[model samples]
Target: MRRGGGGGGRRLPKSSLAPSAASDRTPLLDPHVLHPRNLDLAFSRRDSDAASLCSSRPSSIGTGPSFAAPVTNFSDRASQAAALRVVNAYLAPAVSLRPPLPSAKDIVAAFRCPFKLTRSALKAPGTPHSWPPLLSVLYWLTLLVNSSESGAGGDDSPAASNDLMLYITNSYSLFISGDDDSVASLDEEYSSKARAHAQAAVEASQALEKEALDLESKRTKLTSGPSRLEALQAEKEALTADVEKFEAVVKSWTVKIQEKEESSVHLEKELEAKLMDQQRIAAENEELMKKVDAQVVNVRDVDRMQREIQSVERDNVKLENGNATLEEKGWELEAAVVGKLEEIEGLVEQCNQALRKLKPGIDFQYMLNTKASSPVELLGTSYKTIMKPALNSLADEARRISILKHDESVELEKQSQRNAKILSEKKNHISVCQTKTDEMVARLDSLDVEIGNHVSRCKADARLMKDELEKKDHHLSTVEKESEEFLKISEKKLEDAKRETDEEIQMCARELLKLIDSVTEYKEFMETSISGMRKDLYETVDDISSLASKAASTRQTSAQFVM
Candidate 1:
């Protein structure tokens, strides 16, 4: 009997279960079996297909859905990057990281081999060691083992194949029926494309992650700029103190300049008065010179007149001695006139000394700089314009005095009058002092106007400083308002960033939980694999023990025959 169970890639040891060892075994199976229907019925329950081996487990939703980066419970943009990496892993064989060409059973499950031919080969208890279509006979038997004898090979052709292997998959059994070349060519194409896709995806994801980090850094710097403005404001304050100090120094210098300006104006006024006094003195000197000249001439005339009068008196004496009393009267009158002339000559010398003392020397450029209203104007034309009239008036008075002196002398011939000329000169001196007082009053009025102009200039400067201070204060206020606005805007942006970070963190956390569940799934898969391994080992052990019994019987037969 060709007996097989779920064994394709699970080959039995023929050395252990040979027909020689089965001499006492049942002779139900034989070579050249014609009953394909019987074989199909026999192996129907034991068809080893790739689909029948692996079973899938149901999964449920596991841990966190929301997760994020450190700054927020927000998903790092890394989540997207990780997603891309995972996708790449799926697409690439080089990065697949699955086990190496899996053991035969695993390959069977993965490829879903479509054929099971082991049941088609027939075998009997005492059949020859070399059987035709051996694998097919075994596979057919394996398929028909669980069938009823009538249903075993009733209509099934699967039990009639010659050479094929079987697969056990979760949904169905499969049998692979391809040559080595085809399988290898398919594998190569699949692996190559998968690796290519994986590499490209991983590269793109890495690039994107780096870009995200760069953007985050740029945002941080942009946010810091507003605070830097505050630092700049502090610097401005320090500079403002320096500016204030400069302003104070400038103000002090301005005050000094103002005082200097005032002093300069006062000095200029004083210089004008001194120039006027010099001009007045020069006029007086010129008038005095003319008066002295006139007095000298008068004295000379008086001397000549006295000499002629004496001559006349001599002639009169000669005649009057003949008429004696008339000549005596004329001689007495001439003596008084000569005495007045001597006194006038002494006064003229004194006036000459006074004229020298009162003389004004020329002052050049300053005099030219002055306007035509200056006494310098008259001096440049002629001293006569400034002084000749006064000298004439003085001369008139002097001549009048002289005439009166002559009259007085005539009287003094009889009365000897001397105090009359002195009294008249004193009266003229008082009148000249009154004219000087009037000139002084006009100079005081001009000085008062200049002082008023200076006061107005000072008031204007003070107003300008006050306006500047007001403008500075207004600018400071505007800057403060703008700074406040900037701070508000920056704070709002930070709040928004904080909110975004928090959301991303939540998303990332969820994704992290999903990854953890994936790990758990992997562990479950490993555990399931271990359980399947234990089951397979148990099956293998049971198969081994059955073959050992058959082998022991064959050995006993051989021993008995040899003896």
Candidate 2:
């Protein structure tokens, strides 16, 4: 016989009851066997078995309807009561069979079952309709008992119990509907399933062993992790030190750069000032050139001086011609006076002769005229009247012409002296201007050389600064890359450590749960064994007391007979 609802079916040793006969007749009220006809047939057979078995024993069965009655016969009230009594007797070991035993509804409620079962349905007519739920309740009770007996702690979970119930129900249905051939097939199927289960168990054990080996290897690796972590920490400290040193160097370089910038700014300002000075000098030189241009003698002034000298010379020539003409006229007038004097002398001589003649005649004839004068008196009168006045006018005209020539000569001498003094001053000014121009040219050349040198130096400084900046940029980039790589490695190690710790915690929790379950089971077993022993000790005491009381009563009866 197989223990229904056990973890696995194990065949018990056959007794003298005959397996063939048991297999030929189905058991009564097997909850998994749902067919009505089969159930009735099985009940009839059970009734016959019970009758045969109880022929020599005292009858303690209830006065319900015979088991040979069909399920349809349970419709009447008396039959319903009888079926209820039968169900109660069958389930007496699992539930109380005393009066006021729990009703179907109370049982379902106690088990927290979704299936509805009422007291009325169990005790009223038409019990066939209530059989399925009742059978389900019986199946559930069977699973609970089997789980408790088997000591499999977690198998009583609702999902596992439900699955086992379905499988058993299906199998029992097939078993009831089939013949001997089907029975043999079911045996074969069970044997095959057993073999398959054994194979799966072996595979599971192998997988567990492999997992254990992997876990052991992982544990060994974890044990070595601290040393690597220490090394990484040391490397990180070294990197930090290097970073600090680099930062310090950068700070120093930045200070130097600031100083260089200040110097460069100063140089630029100096250059601007120099440029302004150069511009101012150039403007002053332009003004000087303009002054020189303004002071230079013009061609028109020289031409005008030459024209005045020509006019003065022409006036001198005219004065000389006028003096010659005056001289000639004076000569001609003296000649004419002489000739006229000759003619006048002739006429005067004639007149004198006539006078003389007349005077002579008069003198000769002193007696002829008393009013006759001398010849000397007549000549004196002629000279005083004409020659004296002509000579005096000519002398005054020559003196006036000499005075005009003397004045013109003095003015010409003064003009020539002034022109020479002016020419000397202009020559001195031109020399000074040429000397200043030479000095300015020399200064410009020096300034250009200085500017070129300064520009070259600035360019060299700029190139140096550029090279340094490029080197600094390269160093910074390399530092950043190294830091990033270190950070990534550190992060990976942290994640791995966290995952390992989480797995260890979960494994410990599972092991603790298993230990708790085993301890609970052992404690329960001890309690049950203790309770059984206590009951046996009580029963032994009761038996001994009863035997002592019997012995005492027998002694008293024997003594009474003796009297």
TM-score of each: 0.16, 0.17
Poorest 10 consecutive residues of model 2 by lDDT? 361-370
Q: Which stretches of model 2 miss by more than 4 angstroms? A: 1-165, 178-211, 226-240, 255-263, 270-563
Instruction: List, residue by residue over 18-96, the lDDT tens digit for candidate 1.
Output: 2242333222221212222222222232222212211111111242222111110001223223333433443455544
Lowest summed lDDT across 10 adjacent residues in model 1 is found at 67-76
TM-score of 1: 0.16
* Model 2 Cα shift for residue 196 (angstroms): 9.8
lDDT of 1 at 185: 59
Error of 2 at 106 (Å): 47
Residue pairs with colliding backbones in model 2 are none
Q: For candidate 2, what is the TM-score? A: 0.17
lDDT of 2 at 36: 28
Top candidate when judged by lDDT against the true structure = 2
